[model samples]
Target: MTNAAHIRLLTTLEHSLDSGQQVVSLTNDEDPLTLKDRVDRIERIELHFPHFTDGRAYSQAYLLRRRLGFKGDLRATGDVLIDQLIQMKRTGFSSAVLKDGVDPADAQRQFERFPAFYQSDVASETPVLRPGALEKPE
Candidate 1:
């Protein structure tokens, strides 16, 4: 799970993005592979959720991280919820803008509840929660 500073909760999108930043807003249907050539030039990519039930952005984020190897910020926008933050981080979202009415502190608590996991994710190739898993046996 990401720290409070890592996963930002924005009450609104207005003025959230910095001017002159190399940002790309990709719809759920867009293919992240299309940006492979320009990944290095990009600084941030915003993936939209559209509706709370729509999860295509997750795949998009994964592709951006695992396939395209984008190291820049991966932000989640629109219809984001506190419950989705855990999976969002696992899939490679560096930040999220919480939807209206969601408490930022509550979102922080969610990360606190599950600080690590046993599954391999985009950020790490091996299970992180297991003791000594990161070290090779002699």
Candidate 2:
């Protein structure tokens, strides 16, 4: 989604809440707006997907990117699937941690199969039908 060489894939993480790192980990129910006051100090935010069907993180990611203007790494953690990578990127996730046994190579291939999308998304505001729409956002 970032048009980077490849999608960032992590095998695991130790939630940063107790470590005092610049990372913030939030559950699906947590409001991203609560972090608005200190978002600048944060370097990365990990949003959890308790279940594959639960998608509250998508809205949270949108708020962090569009409303809060967070430019740091937005990672998807827990129950992440290869099929969800595209939408996750479109919704503002910069990286994802694949569930156990999920092959990163196969996950990366998903992007190669669909290099472009027709509709506008968080990564690109312009629709492909419009001129300069495919240009990756800075």
Candidate 3:
């Protein structure tokens, strides 16, 4: 589904609770609660990017998945570009809402280029160093 079709924009905490539907909102600079606390009750949490230059949402997506252990869908909204689709997916965003003028088909094409999982070490417990880092072979 398209990001615009699935995402809830400018959604407030109270409104989200009342609607009982998944919501995604922009992070205010002064919020004291942790990301986990903010999204704990919601079925899905989305991070917003007001502009391409503002990248705080990327960090939020990473924290929501890697640190807070959020399993539900994480989406990216606003100023989303075709170039950013792959990186956004890699950072843990399951989907995104592109800007008003952009084409969804382009975004879909970008999303298809990368594999589902990007990190090689995610499946392994130990860190793997370079081949010649330890010693030379005979």
Candidate 4:
């Protein structure tokens, strides 16, 4: 697996596509640009949270799905924990690269622990909630 920590923006990514640097861009808390702006230009984006306590990356992933409509590969690359994998997939990440010293098998286990469609928006054959509950009270 590639070391995501080594990934960097060699130049203003939007302007330097021809550089062919095999670069992967990451966004931290100070990024002024929106997820849409970043994803629109780059082929891949890694969402980086300096610590597990910081959750801004989750919101960024949510926006990438629900707002930005980014369809390319989205990855979680810093301070990642196995417990977060399910939630990360729910937020639209396709893959995750764990922090240094974490086992790759553990990361693979995170991907396989849940079914592919788990927590997705696929419609069910039967509604678990009563239809009446879905309607406003008159």
Stretches of candidate 3 off by over 4 Å are 2-24, 28-33, 115-138
- Candidate 3 pairs with clashing backbones: none
> lDDT per residue, candidate 2, 1-138, as tens digits?
234744577655433222446889998889999999998899989899999999999999999999999998898988999999988988999888888787777888888887777888888887667877578999
Per-residue lDDT of candidate 4, residues 5-110 (tens digit): 2211112222234333333555766442444455556665668877888888877777765676676666676677767766776676765666556665555565
Query: How does model 2 score by TM-score?
Result: 0.84
Root mean square deviation (Cα) for candidate 3: 7.0
Q: What is the lDDT for 5 in model 3? A: 28
Residue range 9-128, candidate 1, lDDT tens digits:
565643264444699999999999999999999988999999989999999999999888899888899999888988998899988888767777888888789867788887567786
Q: How much lDDT does each candidate structure score?
A: 0.83, 0.84, 0.58, 0.57
Q: How close is every model to the real structure, measured as TM-score?
A: 0.84, 0.84, 0.63, 0.59
lDDT of 2 at 20: 45
Candidates sorted by lDDT, best first? 2, 1, 3, 4
TM-score of model number 4: 0.59
> When superposed on Cα atoms, how far off is each prediction in RMSD?
3.6, 5.6, 7.0, 9.1
Determine which window of 10 residues in candidate 4 has minimal summed lDDT.
Answer: 5-14
**Model 2 ranges off by over 4 Å:** 1-6, 13-20, 131-138
lDDT of 3 by residue, 21-134 (tens): 766564634221365665666666657777788878777777777777776767676677778766666566765665666655665666456534423321222335545658
